[model samples]
Target: MSEAVDPGVAATSEPKEEKPCVQCLVPEIMTAWNSARGACEFVPDEKGREECRKELEEIAKDVKSIKKGSEVIYKAIKSSSNPAAFIQAQIEFAKTHNAANTEAILKWADEMEKAGKEIPEDIAKIVKFYRIQAGSQI
Candidate 1:
């Protein structure tokens, strides 16, 4: 022997085995696809099973890169200021939507009353408003 080589510095003569993908290690997806396939005696809905299998295969190929890029974007949003302003805007949005929804309920109740159906509570509330407007007792 000429000299002993450092194992860390040396190129390995043996071939390294590639690690299985994280996506493949997820049991739920694999089980869902396996059980969904009828021809394999796993379950029924073989076509659906095949689709899930294809989807998982595609995801496995890109998941590591996809996850890394998404985490960057997510972290940026999570650390943002004015998060409360965003939340307030969302609340006001729900209020505006509720106003429109109430208006539609009133209109629908009017139509239904014209068609001879009894007014429900929400519709009755609108009718009560009109009665107060007309100075008439229910």
Candidate 2:
């Protein structure tokens, strides 16, 4: 005899599908690509260098598939050889996507200053404008 089933529950043999966490995937890809980039830089032999390059290329393809319009920023950050360049990419991304996030822009500007990297004149002007606007809001 069949058992009585609760009306609120449905019996199913299929397992629930899990969705990918995009936020987690972005950092994982970035870390992997950055590690491959370093390996490419320090590999002594031509063969090793070629292998690392291949790995980096694969990671680049993954980056492309992750999202549109933002892959350039990811590549810039991943391929940057120095902190200054990385921070520059961050600032540019903030300007493009988080223009209203004045606190973040200011924080990056401060970090650039601390790092002794010259902030671009246009970016400096933007920071100044934002600072003035923020002051007026108080």
Name the candidate that leads on lDDT.
Answer: 2
Which ranges in model 2 have alpha carbons more than 4 Å from their true place?
3-10, 13-17, 62-138
Worst 10 residues of 1 by lDDT: 34-43
Listed in order, each prediction's TM-score against the native is 0.32, 0.35
CA RMSD of all predictions: 20.2, 12.7
- The local distance difference test score of each candidate is 0.48, 0.61
Per residue, candidate 2 scores C-alpha lDDT tens digits across 1-138 of 988888987776588787567786777667545543643544455665565466467657766466433454455445544435444434554454455467899889889989999999999998888778778431
